[model samples]
Target: MSFDVICLIAEWAPAVGACRESRGADFYWDAPENPNGEDLPFAIERARRGFDFIEAGFYYEILRRRLPSRVRGKADSFFGSVYHELGPGCPEPPDDLADDVGIELAKHEMYYSMRPTTVRSVLEHARAVPWPEIEHAATSAVMPPRITRHDVRDIEHFRSIVWFHQDWLDEAARTGRGLIVLISQ
Candidate 1:
């Protein structure tokens, strides 16, 4: 199965919580029915500002290995699993919420997980690594075979995905918004 990494603004916690009340994908797209409940438009705009990177597992693995935990600041050195939080203070979303966003563990090998991190943490981690360094390291990193649904073999393609992630983090820094990291399989 393919892994999709989706980033959403941390401000949408309430909206997310509302939607997650009903498990499965159906609730995620449609806003909750209560008109005065939450600011749907604002949440949507924040989501629009977020990033979605498909099949980036390989590059994630590469960065996870090269980026030392010491410099990760409050951000995770890598993505997380079902049993672990993404990082120290980054707590995993509730089980029902994870299911709603397609991150919950399933019998068909499908799994989804999410963690919230502060804007400062994201900025610290993003600024810690320069773009040129990321590009060079990602391009030169060795990837394990058969680890992902689609393993990226081309260096340019690998660099592009890594760049996309960095750019998203940069945008979050510029906007001064906390981030939610969602990993769906």
Candidate 2:
């Protein structure tokens, strides 16, 4: 019943740095590429090999796994259950990447971008999941104070935050999705 949680480190570098500067082993960083580089593809490729979850603001190849399968005629619908759309102006990842990879990968990207901003929001979302189904909790090593608290809390009122990392190694290991995580060095 272990579920994987992916954190978007590249998108939230400022917040992560702030959290790390303030918090302890609660967060860490491990990126092979210069997150600020101009080449997005190289960044993505390096990320693919290094982490299970990617943190790019723009949707990359790995996120395609998160999308629901679009069969020939069986009510062609996206996997809305786990997929969520971000703000209107947000930059979208390449369509080819999304199409080639699974939509779940996109879902992970969206999740990282839209993680709850408040403790209450996080608590509510975490509580929605049945405890019996969750065996592992994962998140970026660096996160906002509120999100970090939500990912680390052990109270019955909220979902238990089990493990936190900058990559998605835990998620890939659990789901078998060949996704990678991206972060800034």
Candidate 3:
């Protein structure tokens, strides 16, 4: 089955110890009340600042923008999963924003960070590539089982469709909890 990314926001400090025995999608320290589904905000633009698999990549670009120029380039060259999973007692997102801005993963995929490099690539490709080019390209070559390909509209949607909030993402990054992306497909 094709996979989709969802932000699995935890309510309490995640029980990472409990996650040790779980694998793949089970990597989560603890499951939220709902795992396969979560809510979406009502206001479109405000919702845009929250999580949706479609536009979250754009938010990652925003994070990449904050990095120092030199580090940004260096970080660009190194590509692997940039995940910030919860440690034993990972900090939780602000109660006010958490539910309004998180996702529940599909059974087949797990989460990771989209990071700047990936985000940059998405933005650039959106500007330059057409759907055919995407098919010819080894999109997401590094993350094989995952998707690297997107259509012209897909890129537009990424640029405009997803929602993100720097405060929430910043909290996640600062606390070593990262912008969630689905991986391990």
Candidate 4:
């Protein structure tokens, strides 16, 4: 049986189109300018169109899946505080609720600030941990210092182009055959 794979391309509208043209594979391009572009809908209409899905932010998925629960909890608290602060002419929270919310928001802020570094650390941990059970038993297996160092270096390189490089965008502008869709999750 042939497997259908969904590729989510964030900020790489042109390359995604090129790939769809060349490989006949589905493409989804989420970019800043066209947050709700028509690429996905058009692709669906075309007979040979392989592009299937569209989403605004791919980082959110990584953040949701790979980030630790502690970090997520902190983020939630931060959001709650923001909601409270910007309420619709509502009364202030009780002292207990305010204190709890304040602590949670602070913790969340800390986690938000350290997200990049935390991501790097988590990726390092993944590489060091053995297959099948990275969290349970394999995390304790000590890796060489060089391994951690090298992974961090690689992560830095990846951070540079997590979105499509500039050249890809220029190429897309040159070719106006396909659409680039963006959907905010």
Query: Can you give the lDDT of residue 123 in candidate 2?
Result: 29
TM-score of each: 0.46, 0.20, 0.31, 0.18
**Candidate 4 lDDT, tens digit per residue, 1-185?**
11122222222344334444533222333422346764543332211111111110122222324435554443323222212232222222122211222232222111111112222332343233222321222234332244322232222232333223122223323433222222212
Provide the lDDT at 50 for model 4.
15
RMSD of each: 7.5, 17.4, 13.1, 18.2
* Cα shift from native, residue 90, model 4 (Å): 32
Candidate 1: deviation at residue 48, Å? 12
**Candidate 3 lDDT by residue in tens digits, 81-160:** 22222122222122222232254334234343333333343334233323333222223322213244442123334333
Give the candidates in order of TM-score, highest first.
1, 3, 2, 4
User: What's the lDDT for all of these models?
Assistant: 0.44, 0.26, 0.32, 0.27
C-alpha displacement of 130 in model 4, angstroms?
Answer: 34
Q: Tell me the tens digit of each residue's lDDT in model 2 across 84-105.
A: 2322322332222223222333
* lDDT for position 39 in model 1: 37
Candidate 4: worst 10 consecutive residues by lDDT? 47-56
Evaluation by TM-score, superior candidate among 2 and 3: 3
* Positional deviation of residue 6's Cα in model 2 after best superposition, in angstroms: 10
What is the number of residue pairs that collide in model 1? 2
Better of 3 and 4 by lDDT: 3
Off by over 4 Å in 3: 10-15, 27-108, 111-150, 153-156, 161-168, 174-176, 183-185
